[model samples]
Target chain A: MNMSLKNTLKMAIKSILSNKMRTFLTMLGIIIGVFSVIVMVSMGQGATASVTQSIEGMGSNLLNITLTDRTIRFSNDNLSELSMLEGVHMLSPNINWVAPVKYGLNNEAGTSVVGVNENYMVINGYTMMTGRLINPLDIENRNKVVLLGSEVSESLFGQFNPIGESISLSGIKYTVVGVLEENENTLFGDNNNMVLVPYTTGMRQFRTNSIASITIQGTDAASIDKTQSKIETYLMTLYGTDTYRIFNQEQLLSTLNEITGVLTLLLGGIAGISLLVGGIGIMNIMLVTVSERTREIGVRKAIGARRSNILFQFLIESSVISGIGGIIGIMLGILVNRIISTAFEIPISASMQVILIAFLFSLFIGVFFGMYPANKASKLKPVDALRYE
Target chain B: MILLDKVTKTYIMGEIELTVLKGISIDVREGDFFSIIGPSGSGKSTLMNILGCLDVPTSGEYYLDGQEISTYSENDLAKIRNEKIGFIFQKFNLLPKLDAFENVELPLIYRGIKSKRRKEETEIALDSVGLYDRMHHKPNELSGGQQQRVAIARALVGNPSVLLADEPTGNLDTKSGNEVLDILESLNRKGRTIIVITHDFEVADRSKTEITLRDGIIVNRKVK
Candidate 1:
């Protein structure tokens, strides 16, 4: 509340306001820099939520197994024992391989050939757009029938119904049983693209016995922990090793969260570089201001303004600039998030803590970077300064 | 009262040494109207800078109101300038952003005077200079004569012991310059210790006492 400070602030504001275009152009660097940070961070957060929600949408009990320098073995002759274990609900075994699909003489596409039991649709929560899902009788008769993903079906059959149409999988012909509806998710998840086929038919067509993965559904929401433990114990005892990893719904959800967390940090750090550049721009402008206002500084000093008063004046000016930039950047970021959420169907949530953090960070940048110029201005001798032409 | 005992000041440019005031000394009592007249580069400005406590002599002693201020630090010198002396520059260095009242109230702000009392004192000072009606007008809106008057009001607001005028009329026309000189003479007549620095003999003749400098030395003195 010192008068010198009050006067100094008043004068600084008037000076900046008097030159509108120059002030706007000077603030442009901070605007772009802050805008880049806010937009990048918000978009990254939206993308992460999209990916996590997609993974969550895929049934919670899905578990993946990839063999890495270790052999996978199971002693159960049939799959009935796995179903009988405590807290065990149902098991859907899977086998996967790549195959080229053909619809007509010229239309062709490459897709993943997945071997799944009839319970695959039930455990994975997939709906059929046309025809029916895989059945036990089809597996028993070893029928040459396959289901296509929405994308795959559209690419191969066009507007014509693909329920009775014939398609090729690995040089073998199979009738199209159904096409699964497209699930809402991103490219980061595993269900975006694939072709589903009967287990026995897929084994005969590809000639391989390797089980790629197994998904076990829980009895109810309350029995998740029991089911996960039961599945892990049964698998360990059967295989005589605990090398295979077992995951339940909560673990899968947390894994997705962890990945998204890393992505958010990476994006935030990358955007922070631009904020640093903007801070440097402010510092550079302050140094020039100090040079141009040498005589003014002398006048103030001679008029009895303290050194700290001068420093605060410049610091406030820079902080005000950065503060305004932060405000505009936040608005722009929200606008971008809304547009993207509308363009592509997704959900985005921005937290108030993020805005507060960005504002405080910009203020810190102003003070930290403004130190050099403020000190340089404060150190100028009143005598030499006044004599300066 | 102000006293300067054998004061000497020197300047160094690159490697060469130049002395501006060589063992000059003077003393003046309070409420004295005095003029220091000299041509360009006669060390008058340098001596005025020292007398105003804006600069410390390289050697010898200076006393203001019986306090040895030659050894005072920069901060102490600033306090003395704020509390004891008011300066009027030739350029009428009013902050261009501020109006006449703000410029006049500046020293009171440094004196830590309360706002209400400071406003009262500022009004009185501006009215004394015939600028009370134009207190809100900025320097850009005022002519050279009016600006100098505002500057003089600014110097008088704090009721300092001495009013230091350094070529106060140098930048004004003949009529405006005479107006400023008349104001200075009136302030001096009111028993304020007023010291003016000028090269115009006519302006110097208006003061009660005139001290002339030649080659950095005081050569003649006349009492009007």
Candidate 2:
């Protein structure tokens, strides 16, 4: 004789419903375990995504090179030659000088003043809030002109329009060109805290005729790698190997992803322990339930219940409990991700794949842990069970 | 309809191996109402267990419907109990969660009967015991007499060849006990072969045949 799975499930549900409090307590472990796992993974993915996004926004088709060899120097002729290289769209000498900056009464002893040319506006991700950018004429006439970053503008002008105004840098008055928009804070230093000046003025300020740092914008992603290798070859002849280092967005993105990937797994592993404990909880409760219902098992067996029927009855009960808990955990996890992501603006990655994996794992826990108790119940002797009292 | 040849039963408790039933033999024809009367510890319960197929004999041959059952496995015994023997317990062992109709319908569910046929047979069995209106009531909602009637319905729903009742009225009031005894006699009058295990003369007096057992052996036999 065969018992339908539907009837067995019905009976299991009836038993679970009879003891509402204990069943819910058993299910709590699975819910909390699944919820934490989903949230932790989303957080790790969100961090990785935000990093990649900021780097991509900064333009992936660019090369940043810093010269470490102090013996070699880039003359004006050498700068011209490098700019004329194939696939080089634009180039800006990225020279940083920390010096005293003052606007009438305001004075800061160590403020970062960066040097750039006309193409620097397009090469770096910068947008003007007011006034104009440095022009080629300012570099030719060696005129002192500076663009104020959002933070620099706030410190120098105090809400007053700084465009067309003059600020003293290194004891020299330079006319302010424009104020830049506020930029997002990222791992790669803040662009809002610096002041930009013409490279000619900056070279004069640093008292160095040769440029040390350069930011080159390539034509596109396909040609950037080719341009980098060619530049590296030429730079070796000048600065030598291990003397000059270059950075690319693709390399940085890969490294960031690798770190986040490991972090995500670590979080998942920790969460998995809780899920394992939940399964053990189910097994413990199920064993107790089997022993408690000994007489019931005897009655069913006396009435002709096969071992398979009894096995399914208990197995289905455990699955239903954990399955319902899993659904609640998934919804709660997504809700938590939504709340946290909104509270702190970040792109949290929550994919259906993770949800599916967690759900299936919970169901697996039900079956795996329920096996022992169910088998014990099914194998009970009808005579002994009936006489168990 | 039933046959047993020197059937024996023993239980081992630690180092002491005690024989509950030394040797027993019996034969009952089809449609015969049989009764096994004995005092407590006289092996009547053990004999009933063997007859109900809930257990096996220590040694000897048992035949039911011309099929040798002493060598049957546990699963085979379960099937034989399902298809051939119906047991009515003194405690009215109904699962507390289910209603009267569900309790009566359980055996058919295990028998893998379709829902329509199961419903039909369950209704008929409950109606035969005059508890059709109380089918929806749970065990705790009914009195002792009504609970026993429901148990009878459960025992009859499977349409087994013989009904094996162990102390059918052992835990009932005088009136409730008489009511259960009347139901058992009426079922037997309908040509349902029944065997009742009891120590009470009041229960044995109604049966067509009685076998008095003492210390696991038949001491007297009466055929009326």
Q: What DockQ does model 1 achieve? A: 0.26
Interface C-alpha RMSD, model 1: 2.9
Where model 2 places Cα greater than 4 Å from the true spot, the runs are: A24-108, A117-119, A135-145, A154-176, A197-246, A250-288, A325-372, B27-30, B65-74, B173-179, B205-210, B219-224
The per-prediction tally of clashing pairs is 0, 0
- The residue-by-residue lDDT of candidate 2 on B1-224, one tens digit each, is 99999999999999999898888999977888999999999999999999988889999889999999988887788788888888899899999999999999999999899999999999999999999999999999999989999999999999999999999899899999999999999999989999999999999999999999999999999999
Candidate 2 local lDDT, residue A91: 90
Error of 1 at A332 (Å): 4.4
Per TM-score, the best of the predicted structures is 2
TM-score of 1: 0.73
lDDT of 2 by residue, A1-389 (tens): 88788888889999999999999999998898788888888888888787788778888888988888776667777677788888888898888888888999988668889988888888977889999988999887777999988998998898899988889999999999899988776667878888999999888877977888889999897788899988888888876798888887778878988998899889988987898898899999999999999999999999898888888899998888888878888889999999998888877857798889889988888888898999999999998889988
User: For each candidate, what's the DockQ?
Assistant: 0.26, 0.64
Clashing pairs in 1: none
